[model samples]
Target: MTTERQFQHDSQGPLRRIVSSVFSIFETRLELIGIELSEEKERLIGVLFLGLAAMMLTMMALITLTVLIAIAFWGTYRWQSLAAITAVYVLVAIVCALRARAGLSNAPNVFESTLAEFKKDRDTFN
Candidate 1:
């Protein structure tokens, strides 16, 4: 009876350790995700504010320049100048769209670290 009890206790010890280790791993991964989320949020807000400011300044400058160009041409070449400006704007828009698409494609996946940690755990178990 004593030998059976000792064997049971020994089995329980490893089981307890396994459970504890699993919980510890989960807690650590959760903490890392929380930290990454906070950082991403802050970065997004900062980028939004900066983008707004840049857009406002660019619009103001474009308007001012357009008016200046129109006044400079007055009667002659006025239509041509406006057409050229429109063409340039269209080209710039296309380039910006393509670049934005490329940037999105190249961006790293979110939760990459978590996935890596899980992979490590799987490998260890295997």
Candidate 2:
């Protein structure tokens, strides 16, 4: 009996075609998703820059207004006025600090959980 070679001549074999089609679809979807994410990142970065600029401008205006008010009121009080303002500023800062502490305590701690989940997924897939 002569050995015969039977080549796989059908390029559209069911499983291979199906796998190729699925892979192409997945590739297309991933590409589209990447493009969307890149666009979103660009938009978010632009917004961050604009917000930073606005915050800086507002802070500058506020500082100028505060200086003007301070100068206007400077003649009414003695040197003790500066000390009193400093004390008030300190008190306000303490209250803000306390508020920030409370906020931090209430906020979700996601870093460790996120890292763990990321590692788990990486190991499971790869």
Instruction: For each of the candidates, give the backbone clash count.
Output: 0, 0
Q: What are the root-mean-square deviations of the candidates from the true structure over C-alphas?
A: 1.5, 7.2
Q: What C-alpha lDDT values do all the predictions have?
A: 0.91, 0.67
Task: Give one digit per residue, the lDDT tens place, for model 2 in 13-80.
Answer: 77698788667755765665666667767976998899799879977975676576678678886456
Give the per-residue lDDT digits (tens) of candidate 1, residues 19-125.
99999998998998998888888988999999899989998999899899989987899999999988988998899899989998998878898889889988998
TM-score, one value per model: 0.90, 0.54
